[model samples]
Target: MKKILKACLLHSTAVSVSLLSFSFGVRAQTPQTPADEISPPVTDLLFGIERMMGSDSTLVETALEGFEEKYGDAVRGGDHIQGIAMTAGGQIVLSYSRQDPSKENCSGMLIYSSPFDPASPNRELDWDFYCETSNTDINNPPTGLGPEAHPSSLQASGNILAVGTHGGTRFYYLGPNGIEALHPNTAVLTGGRDSTGLTYNPVDRRFYLLNSDGSTAVGKNTIRLCRSDQDISLRQANQAIFTDSDCINIRDVYVSGQGANLIVQEDGTLFLVSTFSTRDLPDNLLGFADDNTDAIWGAYGTRCALETALLPGYGFRASFEDHIYISELDFSNRTADLVMKRDIRRTQAVQTCVDKRPAFRFAGGVATIRNGALLGLWSGRQNPPLLSLNDSYEFAFQDLPQPIKSASVSEEKAYLFRENNTYYRYTDSQGVDPGYPASTSRNWDFDVEGDDKEILGAVRYDNGHVYLFLEDGYYSRLEKDGSTSPGYPVKITDNNWPGLAPYAERIRAVINWGNGNIYFFLENRGPFGGTLLGDGEYVRYNIAKNRIDLGPRSIEGPWGILGDYDTDITAAVNWWNGKAYFFLEGGEYIRWDIDTDETAGPIRTSKYWPGVSDDEDITAAFRHQR
Candidate 1:
């Protein structure tokens, strides 16, 4: 492995100067000792590198004194600073955010330490120093925490501090030492309650901002993202609002210049899920360059959930036409593969399930497309568990909306599903009502039926067929037409399903890769037969060979799961690129790869939308199909 050096220097002095004079292009002076020759402690070596990279001699000397004052002999031993990250270049940087009052000011400080060598083997110098700052505010603002500066994310790129704060999103162009706001103040994303999940797409050279669920001048709980990296004011920020429907909470957005998609998952009973985009339109509403606005134009979002889903080349697909997919807890199994296109010729196109028992269905999380596919998660569904999908409307293309409680997608035609338990696939089983008033076009119904009504999981058409996986381990195939193929659901054994662990109660979720495979999660019970029997376990199912590979269980015995298993599974899984990403209750985010057979993380966090944790009722994420 090639060794990289990064150093931090804390200066105990006040230094505010011009940016050009203190930029990153400082000359590397020939010290008495060569940096390549020193074997000093990593800390000292890193500190030395900072000094050498820096051009300010006064700042360097001051930092050295501070280092000596802080760590006497330890400075030579190099044992501090827990985390480290490097830019594509060799520039070393460190990040720490503190809302606590004890550090400098309430405004959190981000620091960068240059090359500071403790012993210069080439120059005969014993130690080199780097500079640090007390107040690292943007535009040299005051000591208080403001909206623009309460950074949710802080990254250093070139001479810029890429900042995405709760207030608005903007960048601060800083030299090696000083701060400069890059764009006009009015062009920033400073109006929102929170701005997070920011990405600086090098391909497009634009900064993407995912806004939190809050009120804007137009409505409440909307999703907005900006493409301009230099805009400092919210007004100038070219933003696309994903979900404009009333009370839609858009969570965690991702964008790539190749395509634009928004996933909106609401958080209440009948939670509205939808996806919107401008890619498929014939011409721009406000005409500009057709493909420019078609491909690279400014802000716009739509409300057609079905059109977003059926627009075939959507996810994991190479071609792109905007699409949507939705996952809802089916109290009555009648809501399977049901789609009601909004048209005057079709009445009874929309199918509604009247639950005999009390039920709660909602959306929890969603992801927009950037490079590969768009995905959304629907939770709090029963039987089939959670769901994942490439587009929200894929399941609803026909009259019987796929009974996916929850789902997420990795790419076009590839998907994951929860709460599926059927062995038959239905396609074009019913047609739109030819004789209907324009007022009742959405009231159409499809003619399809099977004992396999519950859909535990599904993968989009990789081999020209939408592969459906059920909870009971049944597999069905669906084609473009509304027809059904009574295929056998691939069953997983106790060794494969693993939920049969001595104390395990049931399997929790499943994801379908575009290829012929399925990944399943099992939640077990406690060792002593506690209220909750076991923790969650994972498994993969091979459709071609018909085999299941189970894995070790989780720490939280899976029996007494977080929410009610009677109606909702409370989790979702998605496959992206070649990896499977799973989101579950108790706020867990996990990923696994089939080819690599490696799992990434089980990171746990709460819901991105507010009011989700308050009621303890389950919340799901699903994209709305227009």
Candidate 2:
């Protein structure tokens, strides 16, 4: 046996199984060590590797206990948070303006030693060291980002921290010593265009911005997607193409606020947040982008928002008034909670207009980080896969739609079902029927409950009606007029169908071969009784005989095309076009040549269906020939 044996470290997904085999003396060896030095045995080394790979530790974030008071202490009259970002290591960076109306003013950035304990902040740094005022020293690099500075933006991805100013975007390297500015040569100069809100996308390796439309007159803000990392100009920034029905000027100038910020998700969905809003868009409007069509920020843009940050597992956090909200993605004011509130009066409380609201101290700018990086997003994964042609009418599937559970085709329309009784009435030429992807009602007069309608498999039989295998071993038939056929939806029993009664509850898909036969694929229930490796099998029934003729064969053995995924077949469709399709888990389907019996593909459902995610599986499929 070669010392470097297959059973040693070559386990694909069965590392534990191999280890057990090796320990039982199937082929155990001591193995090699680093530098030929004495080291632990093979078991010890492999166990260490397993422990390292299975590590589930995450960065522990401290509560923002004293964030508000700390903000009041660091800032004085007219100072407000400008931008904020967090590194992958949970380090925080904040930028703010110290511009007092009476003075030239100053703006500066601060780096916190993560989970930001305001009491200590960064152990190595002091607030007095970075912020110098124009009143005291105008020429020297005294404090802040320089005298008379208006606003600056910060973005941290992994160890790379970037700052945006009129001089352009400056990069920084974060080390044990703290953040150090990179050389001017590495800086991406933006021709004095101070990107009010700056973010770095790790996936695309580019910087994105939130800036005002050249007309500061209207104060309209538009997203600037920097095409070139080094050159972020107007031409490169303007990439928005609105829908035909949308009001361009309204959506462009919709959301306006101080210290506005932006955060993009991995799939190109972004949120444009603001500290406070005066004109346009509501509050926390969701933003959508069409990267495939080069149409960005069209209609799905948001309303009012604050500095926002997305944590890996804890979801998004946004501060409003005094409370911070957390949700999977819900930034809406209605459902979001942390539903706390507090307000501090600045100066003296006076009557009428004299009592101007103080600038919001929290969410000045928000960002989340991991692995010492920005944990960037906007990877350009288009969910809708929306496309536009020479323009008659453009169409695409809705984003993140759930996968269909079962489908049946008729002469004119096809019916598709999802969980929660949602269904889509689809068509071939006109695409999906309007007012579909709707929910089916549980108002059926049958004794069956609501869940009993969930379709497990479906097929348009040799008869004129469509047959549906429903939940709880029940079945139904639909007429051409979209109404349930009379006296239908009965439970499956050995009396009606002989051999199928035993496996009726396990049927995953039902198909009509069109040659006077129906076939069924019963789903595997996991190694039968939990002891055997019992894979599911397909059964063939003869419509002429009204009974199962030949069946109970191993799915993988008969259909060599299934490979190692015999138990994973969720749906089967016999296309009217001389092809049979087998749908598997995770939106992948293979084409079977009925005549040749050779498999053509394991193609992605998204490749043909657009909106289906790779993780969404097809439960059942159908097609009927008139």
Candidate 3:
């Protein structure tokens, strides 16, 4: 019987994703009709916060409510919101300059930050952005722009913020306090002339600036990409290099800087910040607030890049008025890219600033409209598999003083870890035997220093043999005489392992599903170049054929009564109960019934599993014989 367990991991060392620690107040999760949300009228609407998520240049909208009333109207760019940049630490920067060369070129940039770090005191900023430009002008300014002129666009990465203008693009220092609006340094790429629609790529440490053909042909434009190696806010020289997709005209249609708005993700994948016109959708069906733009945008396609895609690039207008909205796009359909609003945010707990789709809860069952069509009254994934519980555990796990690194059933159940290069041998009869937790000296080809020496995951075969997985596609097995199998540490190649080779580097855990097949969980990272790489997908390896038998599939459900989880499914064990028990990052356990393929209980380990903490992370789990 598999424990009613369902946890999915999205954690990785190379990716550096901030764990979900933004607990501001009592988490009041009122289960309601799943739909888009429209926050109450906020005085200072700072930014529409966005994060580069998985699923091919996908952008997830987050709700951010509180704002400084004094900073009202600063974020209102009126189609002139040429650039919106986000820092690695979750700071949003917006640029809006008055297009008129008439008055004193007065412009301001507003920054909103909820530093992903839970440690810093200011990280809990109550969702406010400070206005520290040369001058301050709020609601009183004519058209709210307040003589705002060019710094036509903006882009950011790490701690550096770049502001682009018709003359040239300059860099500014973004310290912890606020942006150094006073000091402006020039970047080498934009020193000669004006540039707009710029973005930063963290993957390769390069800056991609959008260059247009400077035409006014309606719905037609030619755009290219400029690569800069100099670090942000630095003054260096490098010519604009355009080749392949960079040189080719994505779509020879449009005016100056009006093709597809450029946005490069951390993984160096290029995408367009596309939008849709939603004026025709019935006001009742769309459920938008009184104050908003005529259009809604919610997609960044995987095929909008220059070189590879044949379908035209350069997105259409993202908004019709000052306050724009975002909607979900149906990428699979591949027809009309845009869709109307539906509160997918409520299901994901995504807080945002300007998406007023509607309250998640409706009086009755609601109809989710997509692409001007009804998606039925039922909610999609109403709730991410929440491993929540009404009952509390009386006792906590005390055995694992340190988090388990790699666990497998072997001679006394081997647990190889990196705490000073040692492993623990726990027995079902006596628990930790005398002189346990010994060094990994005897493990052949392992027992080295650094990352190569660490065991990421371990699994046991029916014969009671143990296998240890290492970094860069290598694995070793234990022999009968308490020694590693000779000629071990072999590469898990396509010829040998077939289905698991390409992902050998990203595998976080392995499981021997007592049913004669092995399961491997793959780790995923975000916005790699063009797609969300390192997707947390799992594959089933058939022991009989020694190749992939089932999937490279997502843990999201329809998964045999096993709902998906937002957290990472770190480790699992084929328990003695004849079920597969899975463990998550937070000490929660669930199981899968081998016979029925039905799943049950993501109950806290504190209930039955001895010595497990509430928030303890389990790295490896397996059944062992004494």
Alpha-carbon lDDT, every model: 0.29, 0.41, 0.38
Candidate 2 yields a Cα-based lDDT of 0.41
Candidate 1 wrongly placed segments (more than 4 Å) = 1-97, 105-163, 170-193, 196-365, 368-371, 375-473, 480-626
| Candidate 3 Cα misplacement greater than 4 A, ranges | 1-68, 73-82, 96-107, 116-130, 133-153, 164-168, 182-208, 211-218, 222-626
Decoy 2 TM-score against native: 0.35
What is the C-alpha lDDT profile of model 1 across 69-109, one tens digit per residue? 43222111111121111222212232222232233432333
- The residue-by-residue lDDT of candidate 2 on 1-626, one tens digit each, is 00110111110110010000112233254422111111011111111112110011111112222333332233343343444555544445555444333444423434233332211221222211123232322122223323224344555544555555544444554445544443334344432333444444334444444333222111434433332242222111222211112111112332223334445455433344333312122132333332322222222121111111121111222222211111111212212112211121211111011102122222233343321111111000001112211101100010111111233234656555554344555576765564344434311222274233567787877766677787778877766544567887888887777678877888888888778888898766555554157687788989898889887777776778774777777777777677787778776888887777888668886676543445446565566665
Best model number under lDDT = 2
Which 10-residue window in model 1 sums to the lowest lDDT? Answer: 390-399
Positional deviation of residue 461's Cα in model 3 after best superposition, in angstroms: 7.0
Candidate that would win on TM-score: 2
